[model samples]
Target: MITVFSLIAGMLLTGMNYLVYRQLIVSFLSKKTGLVCISVITICTVIYISGLRIVELPDFLYKTGAVCLGLSFMLFVITLFYMAGKWLFRQVSLPVNQRKRRFLSLCFKGAIVGAGAGYVSTGIYSGKSLPRISTIPIKIANLQRPLTIAQITDIHLGVFLQKDFLQAIVHLTNEQDPDLVVITGDIIDMPPEAIGDTLDPFGQLKTRYGVFCVPGNHEYYYGVNGILARLAQLGITILGNRTKQIAGINIAGVYDLAALQLQRGPFPNLEAALETRDPALPTVLLAHQPKFIEHVTPDHRIDLMISGHTHAGQIVPFSLLVLLDQPYLHGLYHHDSITRIYVSSGAGFWGPPFRCGAPAEIAVLQLTEEHRSASFLRK
Candidate 1:
């Protein structure tokens, strides 16, 4: 199934690039040169989508491929729109000269190319920038005092996102002085060996309660057992369909539903995970995917659920496509009268190493008394 999907994605990207090259560049260049350029792009796309599975390539190649793919996709969309406009204008009678037509075409093509490059560059730069800290206060009954929890999710530390990025994020999170630090999922995308020095920074994370984590779908794709063991070694507790008590709060976590989707085993058992000492005490559930709320019941003891996985469509039009799958793309949403879920756009980027529409974020949730008015803090 993975192979089939990769094939389809590679073919689609190659076809789009080919169409863009034929429409925009072929007129200015020889037919033989255009074909060769398209062929090279097709081969590279195939190698990138599937060949990585068979053999490991340098980190630079992955970064280059991602940038190229993003740029090509943007160019393809621009060319398609231009073609449509040309067809529309052709329907009307218009006086034109060969040189003027060529000049206009060149100018429009140049503008689109410049705009596409700028978009891709800006997106990548945004992903690398420090994530803004967004503090939102929520009311939960049975809480003694306000509790602040800092959340970092989907920090896919691999290839483009390296150890330095992780370290910087950790530093920023520590500055918040949160009571608890939670990593929702997609903590790492590369294999253990490829992750070399990145794992140690997680150990540097400081919190009064502790650093808690739940498995994201990426963990399963990379290697669940190995990732869990490494996380344990880093002093981060792995909550696999289980509950833990911390700072007088009941925290429960379930494996990602992707485990079930991938047919891993009898995991992500929400019932077992929801087991709490005192039903009256406020409970928080750490679920990797937002859609997992479907398995929850209104009568359940959960007060707040934290999730990440949908980068809120990291890019523009792609963000729209994300809505087809994720229930809450980003931000806090009321799931029920007693239960609420906060979905982070993610602390980092996944693929393409770019973020166009959705800016990365670190969610700082302050649980206050129910009677307290809502408050938002930005830094």
Candidate 2:
């Protein structure tokens, strides 16, 4: 499945590069030169991205490849948008002679190149930075005292992120003095041997109710059992289609949709995960993908659901494409008028290191009866 998806993505990227070369690059240079430049760079980039999955690379090369792929995709998308806007303008404006048309075309091409370069450059710089903490207040009718849960998700721990980054995240989460910490999946993306003690930082988490984790698609790719065991050693509970009652809240967790598709374990049984619960107690479900909100029914009477998988598209125009699969790209949403689902932008990234428009976040959700439920994006 990974190979198939990679091939499809490779084809799409190839087509985009070709189009950019012909439509934009050709305006500045000879066709032969443009073709050579695009072809060489495109080939190298594809290799870099594909290499990330096949073999382990040096940190420098790995980061370089990741940035290369992100910059390529961003430039293509921005150029496409620019061309679209220009076409729309041409449709509305009067026709011009060949000379004027050529000049305008050249100007548009230059703008696309310049703007795309600047955008990608900025993305590379911003992507590696630490995320901000989004403090959200949620009211649960049954909660006795205020509860704070620090949600960490999609931290694809492998080549891109190491123990230092994980420690920093743990430090940040601990500073919040959360009651519970929930990992919404995509935790480990490499093999068990490769991971080693990189996740030891979790041992330092300072949560009262302890930590709970749900499997993301990336977990299945590496070694879910090993990864889960590592988390377990740190005194964290693994909730795979299971529920744990801590304090007065029923926290139920379901596996990601990838579990069913990959046939790694029993498909996500939302019913089983949610069954035999105290209906009176406000229920909080930890699901990896935000789309899991769709499985939630009004009869379930779930008060809140937390998820992080989309990475909020991780990049700009790319986020628009993420919408093709995900119902809500990011942020908090009121589903079914009874359940409030919050889809975090994820604490880490996937393949591409750079986050274009979507910033990484560690969401601190407060469940209390005092304040009305509200969310804010301060950063």
Candidate 3:
């Protein structure tokens, strides 16, 4: 039943995409195609909703459904706003014209609306002080002292982020005065050539144990090696399937899943990287994508694994999709008795400048000891 419902929903979404595409093309083509697209979309939506067992949904899922509906409505409004702006500017070629004036006016209106939508969406999806600090402390037997690590990931420093935002992130991170700072990738959407000036602010970040990073899918899309070199120049240690020691802790980082896939071999051997290190010693894995956890074993003696890739889905309806793809979507999860994983939602947005469901985040993780029980039970 659930599979059937999902199929119907998928079809509806596909039809909606077709309608949106038609709407975009109709602005330059014919109205007949636009009408047909809308008709198909309407029929699909009707069938999809009608076939769903909405009455049987759990309370939490029902609430999620409501949020998804709201998001869809907002997306529809944004699409209309864009279409309206396109139509209003169809004839304007010059910088100074009546149509240009009207287009600017519509942009101002759209901006106001977009801001409100962003605020509302951010509030709804924002979990306070998350990827929450777990009270069940991680015990690293070899560590003589506790380690303070600051993690910032998915800082998609493009379109939406600039100097001011980067400054704020640096300030917030610096406030912690962490022994080590790790960035888990997606630093920018494009190559340094496209955003070198905008990315200058990241060079301001300071950490005592040094800042480290691994490539995200976006970095691969742009140019992984070049991006790594650029970040290296900024004093960030790019850990491409490698390991480094910081304050007696073994920190291992692997390239993104995309990179691993491209290589098409037994690449990023976490076991090989950690082989020289003492199993009793504390180990921190800085994998860019959370999906890496699936291949790991608790017996490997890893203490903490930190990652970011989901962006907590970035928007409503899509968050569910992210969850479906990864066992640990966001926040901390214990795989077995030894290994603990923390998946950050991400520090910035991708594609859309607006961050709907997930707010940008910087995670501060403090390593501590867990209490042991002396009592023994007879089975």
Candidate 4:
């Protein structure tokens, strides 16, 4: 499946690059030089993106490759948009001369380049620096006192998210002095063999009720058992369709969809996880994907569901693509009268280490009494 996806992506990227080169870039250059430049760029783009999945390159090379891929895709999308606009103008009889057309194309290209650079800079700054703490106040019935829970999701501890990055996040989270810390998923991107000690910083994460996690799709990709073993070693409890009583509240988690798709194990059994829980207790469900809410029913006693995996589209424009599948992209969303979900953009990135439009965040969910519930009802 990985190989198939890589091939398909490579083809799409190659075609987009070729079209952009021919229409925008190569039009201004000599045929020979343009052909050579386009060919080289296309080859490098395909190899770098395709190799990212199969090869374990050095950190520097991996980051560089990822950035290049991101820029290439961004350029393609921008150029496509520009072409569409130009075509629309032509349909209205606003034909442009060769000189003016070239000038406009160059201007659009420059804008795309500028936007790409800004995105890369922001991605690096956001991913490498301490994450911004996002506080979301939620009201749940049957809660005795306010509870502050810090959520770290989609850390993706791999080439882009390194040990130091995790260390900084841990320190930042601890500073919040949260009552409980929940890891919704995508904690690691690399396989166990290649992960090394990058995850060592997780042990330093401090919370009153300890740290708990649920699997993300990436965990299954890297082998769920291996990730679970490592989490155990790190003293982080894996909540697999199970519930743990913390602060007198029922904290439940369902295994990621990847487990079912990979046929690695049984899908998360919500019934089993919630059956023993006291109905009066405020229940929080830790699901990795926000889309999981589609399966939620009115009978479920869950008050809050924390999730990640959308990355809020990771980049602008691409978020439209994410919205096609996910009903809720990021931030707090009320699914129904009884259930509310908070989807984190993510603590780290997956591929380019850069965030465009959507900034990475450490979501802090403050559970309050239902007194404010009427004012915060979902429209």
Candidate 5:
């Protein structure tokens, strides 16, 4: 099934390559040149996909390929819109001579090329910039002083982003002086060998109670066990389908659902994680994917859920597509009277180094007693 899915995805991307070539290149360049461009992009797309799934490649080549994939996707969308506009205009306009029509076509394509390049450049700049802080005021269960949580997720360190990014983010998080720090998942993208010393800064992350983490699907692709071990060495608690209590709150985390597809275990057992929960204290569940909220029933009475798998689509158009797979894109949602979930746009970028539309964020949640009674009722 995995192989079949890969093939289907590969064909679609390759097909998109052909469309981009036909729309942008065929008119100005030779057919042979267009074919070569398509071939090269096809190879890069394969490398980018393979690099993400299992294979490891040189960092330079891997990053280059990923960029090519991004460019192809961006141009493909521009081409679609351009073609649609040309068709509509032709339908309404008066007929013109072939020479005039050809000139107008050339000008239109030129404008499209310029616009596409501008969009790509802006996206790259935005993606590289540090994420802004999104402060959220939420209400959790339990009775005690209000608490603050700094959440960092989908930091995909290694190939695209490196220690410099992490270092800066760590600095930003430290400045918040949060009561607790949590990493929902997809923190590392490279193998254990490639990630040495990259996580050292995590040890420097200061918080009142300390840092906590859970596994994301990307972690399983590499060596999750080793990654978890390294986090432990940094004094960060690794909660894979487990619970922890701090400051009158029960914090439980479930392993990402991707574990099931990967056949990786210590599989996510939510039931076991909640077994240690204290009913009197408010409960916050850390999950990688926001869809996990579906598991919450009246019996489980959870106050707040933290998640970060969906990068809020990471880029435009794709953000709309993300809704097909994820229940919530970013920000907080009221799942039920007792359960509220916050899905971060993610602290890092994943594919294109292009975040157009959906900006990245470092979510700082301030849990107060404002909606304590109206938001969650003790069952």
Candidate 6:
């Protein structure tokens, strides 16, 4: 099934590239430069798509292919915007003659294309820096000590990210001196061969209670068993549809939404995971996608749930689509007094790599004893 989809998508992309090449050569660029650009684009696309399928390529080439794919998609969007602008302008009466309108159309397309290219460049060049930390203080009734939990998600490490980026994430996370660190998944993009070295820095992260992770859809895309083994080797615990206890706080995690669809029995089982926990103690759940909350209820005794995977849409109009799909696209939402859900915009990016309104983040959750005056702060 996967192979069939890959083949169909590959053919469709190839056809689109051919059409784009024809349009560029015949209408957009000068004869000589058009040929050159067309050849370059075609070669790049072919090499990239081929690399995505060829398992034997050197790891660096595979990573390069992933980056090129992102660039190609960005370029496609630029073309789309240009086409849309042209169609929109034709509908309105311009305060100019045909010649002037032609010039304006060219200028408008140039501007849009330039803006898209600039965004792609920025996304690519913005090396992983210290992620912005937003700390939310929560007080539980039965917790004896103040506990700080750091949550990060969607560190898609295969391409456009390196050890330096991972190191920066680790440094920023360690600065909080978290008692426990939870990664809500999509930690790596490609297969282990493509990202093994790029993921090494994760091994350096220090957490007193250790790092816990649930698989994201991308992990399944990369081969779940292989990724799990590698994560285990790096000292990260994989909580696949299971629960664990830390300092009296029950931490439970479920597989990605895609996994749940394929393996339905594991999820909607918070009751089973929390069987040993007293009803008075606060429980935290790590779910990869925010939509999973639809299957849960406020009466589940789940105090807080952390999730990522939407990337807050990662782009503008696309984010609107996400809002329609997710109840809590980004930020915290209280489901009655017993259950609260916080959805991270994600610490890393996917697809085109650019993030518009959504910035990467590292969430610090300070769990304290419940007090009358306790409140949540947004930074």
* lDDT scores in order: 0.81, 0.81, 0.66, 0.80, 0.84, 0.72
Candidate with the greatest TM-score versus the true structure: 5
Name model 6 segments beyond 4 Å from true.
11-27, 31-43, 46-56, 95-106, 127-130, 136-146, 189-204, 221-237, 260-269, 315-317, 320-328, 335-337, 351-357, 368-379
TM-score of each: 0.88, 0.89, 0.65, 0.88, 0.92, 0.77
- Each model's number of backbone clashes? 0, 0, 0, 2, 0, 0
Worst 10 residues of 2 by lDDT: 370-379
What's the residue-level lDDT of 43 in candidate 1?
Answer: 68
Question: Which candidate has the top score in lDDT?
Answer: 5
Q: Candidate 1 regions off by >4 Å?
A: 27-34, 52-55, 84-111, 193-196, 370-379
Please give, for residues 1-379, the per-residue lDDT of candidate 6 as tens digits: 5466556767766666656555433456776776676556555655666655554456666555555555555556666766677689889989668898788868886787679768776656542334589787775666767889899898787556667877888889998999999999888877776565676777888888889988787887777778877888889988776778777778888777776655632343555655665565678888888888886786777878889888877755467778787777777777566677788877877755566557788898888875522345222
* Candidate 2, superposed: residue stretches over 4 Å from native: 1-3, 29-33, 48-64, 85-114, 371-379
Worst 10 residues of 4 by lDDT: 370-379
Higher-scoring candidate on lDDT, 5 or 6: 5
Encode model 2's per-residue lDDT on 1-379: one tens digit a residue: 6677667777877888888786666767899998887786677677776675666677777766676677568757776777796788678763468888778777777777788778887777767888789988876777867899999998887777778988999999999999999999998777777777888998899988889999888888777888888889888899988888888889999878887778777468888998867777889999888778888898888899998888888988678778888888788777766788888998788877888788999999988887664444211
RMSD of 4: 3.1
Best-first order by lDDT = 5, 2, 1, 4, 6, 3
RMSD of each: 3.4, 3.2, 15.1, 3.1, 3.3, 4.4
Clashing pairs in 6: none
Cα error, residue 303 of model 2, in Å, equals: 0.8
Predicted candidate 6: what Cα RMSD to the true structure? 4.4
Instruction: Give stretches of model 5 more than 4 Å off.
Output: 1-3, 28-30, 95-107, 371-379
What digit string (tens of lDDT, one per residue) describes model 3 on residues 1-379?
A: 6567666765765555555555543543477876665555445444434334333344344334444444443445455665676676676664678898778766756674676467556645552223222222344556657777788888776544556676777778877777788899887866666666666666877777889888787887667777788878888887776778778788888777886656642246676667666555588888888888887786767778889998887765468778788777776676667777877878776544344556667877767664422221011
Model 4, 143-262: lDDT tens per residue? 978899999999888766688888989988999999999998898988887777888888998888889999899888787778878887999988888888889799998998877777
